[model samples]
Target: MSPLIDCLLIGLGATLIMDLWGLVRHPLLGMPLPSYYLVGRWLGHMPKGQFRHQAIAKASPVPGETLIGWLAHYLIGVSFAALLLLITGSKWLTSPSLTPALAVGLVTVLAPFLLMQPGMGAGIAASRLPNPGQARLHSLITHGVFGLGLYLSALGLRLFN
Candidate 1:
């Protein structure tokens, strides 16, 4: 496969794996993990008192927004794969090293710290969350899983290659 295509696959596969895991685990923890459309519906149904505060969370990201977010997620994955290709060439994709993958995966910090948190009105990086420490920790773990997914997928591709 072409290098760009390989990168795209790597990213998409990683995201799906992580998201699937979320679906399985979130319910066990009593959290409602809904699709973007569900989120929109829930927001519409929110009590009037909390509506202002949760406007962003309630407002389902439009299809365009969802598409853009997914594309960004994929691009982020592709970028990591591309980096691996540059560093280790064909061998990297076949058995991409965890060190680089983890390092590159750190970029996920941007999502919560900047875009998502602010949009949700939680302040930068969720500094304003009720339990900032726990929230930040959760974000870290989630992103860490994504990073691991990238590393493992790269290893799989390496073996396949």
Candidate 2:
């Protein structure tokens, strides 16, 4: 398969794995599942020149925000995969190593720590949340899982090929 196709598969696979982790964690740990609708709501307002929200949960709801958030989630995953391929080269696709994939996954936490969280009003690295430490830990673990997922997905794809 082409590099683009490989990236898509790996990215989507990794994202799906992360989502599954959330599903399992929610019931087991009493953690609430993320509402992508909020993400969509945040993104939906971008065109209107709105970027930061004191509390995204309290922000005005947007039509089709759910679909928008979900789509954006997958697209971001795919983009990450492409980024990994770009950084490590397409040769990694055939070989499918764990180190690079995991590294990229871990590094992706910066998006939420610096950009997403603050934009959604959670503050930097969720510092403004009630339990900032716990939230940060969860983000770290989730991103780590995403990194593992990247390696696992790459391995699976390599095996199939």
Candidate 3:
């Protein structure tokens, strides 16, 4: 398969695994998972406001919009994986060290912390949440899972190759 195709599948797969695990472990339904699939819906319906807090709440995407968000989210993941593949090439995907995957995963935080958060009005690192500390911690954990997903997906790809 083409690298892009491979990356797309890998991204979706990783997301599913991590998300399912989250559902089973902590079933907060909307609050925690927020139907990640609706990332685009959330982005699309985002209320226009200068204030970060207001904007995020205004962009409150519903379950109906989740499909778009999920697609967008996975696409981003695939893009991330493809970048890694390009950097290291196929060899890396097949037998990548956790270092690179983990690095990429961890570094991925910038987008949410900076753009997404502020745009959504949650403030950086979720400073706008009811409990900023817990929200930040939760985000950290999820992103950490994403990093692990990268590493595990690489291992799986390696096996296939």
- List the global CA lDDT of all models: 0.63, 0.92, 0.68
Candidate 1 local lDDT, 1-161, one digit each (tens): 77777777777766666676668768676544624433333333343433333446556444455555555555665666576556667666755778776766666667658855665667787787788887777667667767777787766666676
> How would you order the candidates by TM-score, starting with the best?
2, 3, 1
Rate residue 61 of model 3 by lDDT. Answer: 55
Q: Which stretches of candidate 2 lie over 4 Å from their true place?
A: none
Which residue pairs of candidate 1 clash? 43-58, 94-158
Clashes of 3: 11
Alpha carbon lDDT at 108, candidate 3: 77
Model 1, position 52, has a per-residue lDDT of 32
lDDT of 2 by residue, 54-144 (tens): 9998999999999999999989988988889999998888788889989999999999999999999999999999999999999888888
| Top TM-score hit | 2
Worst 10 residues of 3 by lDDT: 48-57
List the candidate 1 regions with Cα displacement exceeding 4 Å: 34-54, 58-91
Measured on C-alpha atoms, candidate 2 has an lDDT of 0.92
What's the CA RMSD for each of the models?
A: 6.1, 0.8, 3.6
lDDT of 3 by residue, 83-129 (tens): 66776677765567878766777777777888777666677777777
